[model samples]
Target: MAEHNTSEERADDMQTQQAIAVEGLTKIYGTGESRVAALAGVSFAIDAGEWVAIVGPSGSGKSTLLNLLGLLDRPTAGRYALAGRDVAGLRGAELARTRGELIGFVFQSFNLLPRETARTNVELPLVYAGVPGAERRRRALEALDRVGLADRAGHRPPQLSGGQQQRVAIARALVGRPTMLLADEPTGNLDSATGADILDLFAELNAGGVTLVVVTHDSTVAARAGRVIEIRDGRSYERDTVRATPAQVAAPRQLQGVLS
Candidate 1:
């Protein structure tokens, strides 16, 4: 496995070291008196298939960064390259098309249609991509099998438990086989055990070489990632990569006041 990874890294280096590259990225809202800077010269690179976690307190530029990376918002200044192609300037139909083809997103809220079954919900992305009905079912079923949800494919959101619903959302994200999976607080709505199960699924996907960038405030969630990055006040606190196992990063945050 180590040798295989080395070969893959060599191949990646032969092309480019970055899967997603951002340089001097900035985002500003409004103008003059009402203007606010969401991102100020933010820059980062995520290598192909790297599991990176973005952690920060509320109002911290976590969501802002995710939006830019996910192609949901355009940057005010600077450059962003996705898979070696310049995407910062893409607009209108071209931008939307590129995003649809290159990115998959998972959210804290399952975001599944409550009225639809899991299989149907998972098929929606392929449907938008214009895949034929037969092919869409094939891919969606494959994705559900990968996430261990094939047995529950017919269950509606209301009929399934929280964890099962999140798994369905993951199946939908995977059905597209996108270049990157961008998740925003994916386990925020679940109880601890269920959230851990979701994190375990992420770990499995990362092991299979899916590029993952997760934005989360939960320390336990952050611990599951291969690399953890902290953002504070719209700026990075520690840019250096630190090597730590899940056990290391999971140390309980020290409490300052009386216990409950």
Candidate 2:
């Protein structure tokens, strides 16, 4: 009984410190013979302010776990808590609201509106939250400035370089002031040089206390994170938990050629 109480207390403490926590998370598609388990009994906890990378080859369940972490999908059976709130059962408007309020996502494709300016793109989440227009613009500009894109706020997606468009996407993600940033293959669309720059930006943001969780198959990207969660065969394990130093982040292997 004492041990049980202690375990429960520890879990409560973890909930206080963790940005994300999942236990026995499972996802399945179809039924009976056609059933495929994308994730099977995966569990992990990420503390607030930690930078983590989720890595796996194609069909390794990394993307499936990311989708769950981002609240884009629900698990078939498991417990998930986001910032201490039990989110496993939320649906419809409540789920959407929880997702928008607690998490921000950056995608490989730099999903920005081609017709909107950078400032407008960044202001989108605020618009969804029904923030006043003046405040939305102000917050959007602030977020753009954080990503070092303030000068290009008036530029549309087509006018920006691939790297710049991604930076704008990052700014949009940050504008929501989410508990954590969830990035799926954030550097996949950029050249090595530009990707290195974006990685540096991620390092900078992590240094400034923004919690980040990046999903990628790139070993170089994973090495830059403080922890690496490697998913395989529908399960995940901590592959490494060595916090990367600034020097290490600055000179990742992909940047070697550029630096040389």
Candidate 3:
């Protein structure tokens, strides 16, 4: 009985150490009758290395939830724990430091400097993290290589194709070696083929033990995750596990098909 009790306690401790923990997270805008509750009592857990897709309709609190999780916005009530640390109350430099070390961000706009080369753009995160110059270049080049953009390292954003530019953005995200990635509409600006390529890269990264939380309303994009999390009025709804049916399966293919 004592051994069994010890095992149970260990399991509970493991859960507490998850990559993310959201509890009763609430965010409100305005005051009085005009007050808009962006998030209600949203709560969920994301384990390290899990690829979780969050899908919801417009005004469904998707962006609001992401902002909270990313530490970019504050919660009016409740708590958030990232890597087991309570960050709900952190502000200013403390919050900025935590955001730098623990989280990576990717946006749909391919937020790269048009004037900077792919390699230079990928180095920006390291610069913020205060890594040494030589080490920064090494890591940036490694990241670019990982995303198959090494050949285009010297090319500016305008010179690279849209797909390549997105890849550069992804490399920038990874260059920080962050614990989890928060992508908001990562493929929103790309064509179908290009978007598919970006998804493939995400799969490859997730397979290699990078945690992913993607905010997308696109059904096809959401379907690629092992689990789908929907946020409505700031509450999380883990609707169902998503998988490709036998009819939907294709021949063994590249990174894009791995999740499916």
> TM per model?
0.78, 0.79, 0.79
lDDT of 1 by residue, 1-260 (tens): 34667875665553453567666678888899998887776656667788999987887788888888888888898677787667856888888788778788886677899999899999998888899999998888898887778898888999998778888888898888887899988887778876887788788878877789998988888877878777666655333542332211211111101001
Candidate 3 local lDDT, residue 177: 84
TM-score of 2: 0.79
- Model 1 collision count: 0
Per-residue lDDT value at 225 in model 3:
82
Off by over 4 Å in 2: 1-13, 31-34, 240-260
Candidate 2 per-residue C-alpha lDDT over 147-173 given as tens digits, one digit per residue, 9 for 90 to 100: 778899999999999888988998898
lDDT of each: 0.77, 0.81, 0.79
On the 0 to 100 scale, the lDDT of residue 251 in model 3 is 17
Considering summed lDDT, which 10 consecutive residues are worst modelled in model 1? 251-260
Tens-digit lDDT string for candidate 3 (1-260): 33666876756555543788766778998999999988887767778788899887788788788888888888898767787777856888888889889888886577799999999999998887789999999999999988778899999999988778878888898899887899888777677876787789889878887889999877778888877887765566777522321111221122112112
In terms of lDDT, model 3 sits at 0.79
Q: Candidate 2, residue 52: CA error in Å?
A: 1.0
Better of 2 and 3 by lDDT: 2
